[model samples]
Target: MPNATGGQPPITGQVLFYKDPQPLSAENHGGLGVRQIAEPFAFLRAAHAVPVTVTEFGVAAASYPIIFVGDERTPVAVMGVRQGQNLFVDQNGYVFEDYYIPAFVRRYPFVFAADESSDRLLLCVDRAAPMVSNQPDVPFFENGQPSKFTTDAIEFCKEFERQRRATTDFAKIVASMDLFEQKTVTFQPRDPQGREVGPVQKVADYWAISEERLNALPAEKYVELRNNGALGACYAHLVSLLNWSKVVNRAVRTPPPGQAVS
Candidate 1:
């Protein structure tokens, strides 16, 4: 079962792009406002991977490798091969042009918090976000009621919560089938002269659905997966692995000095 507080725990200790997340309330932040998000993705500069909802598999697969992580088998869109480096985000905090931004990134600063006791979901915002303010721009509340912007944000968060629950269920199905396997992605590093040096470096090692195992599933189970819409998502994940090369190429073009490109 998903946690009543949503699928994962609350944002804490620099989870992804959020700095300080606080539950929205009439008393503590009735006068706060959020400046229009001019740089929608400036906060994602330091994130190499972002959680992705199941519905985004088709579009996310086209731009980044989709993989599962951790014991929960949470799906993620891989943006970089190295830690603390996001190939898609430039130094200026601008996401690369033409990339399909995930909903997880688009819904930044606002999230839904489910109260276990009351079974109620509360809308929350990151207090430390640059867009949050008190002096103007777009107020969260107008005349003691939620402003249009706040309403829209709440709607977006609600939809994301729905999708997140679906994703969690899908992950459980996949795990139950025992289709995942540990996979290692290796890269050949080059010296200053652009000549290959050292043995091939293992860039990343993570679990993914094994194609062989998937193909070997019983006919009845296979049909069940297809009927439940997991088949398409599984295929999308397999196809997205090809994009790992693209990540490596982008990193090579702007190689960080020393220690084999950070």
Candidate 2:
């Protein structure tokens, strides 16, 4: 959007899956809005992993392995073993079956970004998103006021921000307890005659919550975790690791765009 001086407005921050996010405003986005698309989640096809909230651990465990990445030990659902591949999502950008969809993916196109000018978070949109259009079925504004769609989106963003903060606190608590361990994920392809052939290929290496260590912690600390509502998430993550084979199977079955399965 053009400013009064005919220059583009400043961008707040760079976020994942958001290429060109602009702060939502009635003045700038009055004519721009979002609409439903045939494949709303097509963007997820290229996302190998995405941030997930701690609260989603139990359900998310059934679909994908939740691992921690980056310095913050941020938990994420590992979608595909290969880079830019989401095995669950087909070429058409849709899930192959009914799976637990992360809230992060559900709230795409609309995200909350901190406005440097104000202490509060500002609602932003990825103007380049496929669902965003010049002629939108759901207008962001109605007569210079936020439409119901936009208001609901705002509420969703607010809740997401709350969950994000809670998830961050959970990570911090776990980190403080020193319950994480470095782990590697790998796969080996088998050949005919039921023989395992080819070199062992590494899928990923990440930080994981150590169940043994968690069990060894002081009783008071464990109680503290339980009280803070982190014990369940920790165990849920541990259990989710078993799904690594599921992700690997999908990866092996569905090779990269130009590659053949070994």
Give residue 36's error in model 1 in angstroms. Answer: 3.8
Residues 70-155, candidate 1, lDDT per residue (tens digit)? Answer: 99999999987767667898656678888989998888788766554556676778888888888859888887667888788888
Give candidate 1's whole-model lDDT.
0.81
TM-score of 2: 0.93
| Candidate number achieving the greatest TM-score relative to the actual structure | 2
Candidate that scores best on lDDT? 2
Residue 27 shift from truth in candidate 2, angstroms: 1.0
lDDT of 2 at 65: 99
Runs in model 2 deviating more than 4 A are 1-9, 258-262
Against the unseen true structure, what C-alpha lDDT does each candidate score?
0.81, 0.85
Question: By TM-score, how accurate is candidate 1?
Answer: 0.88
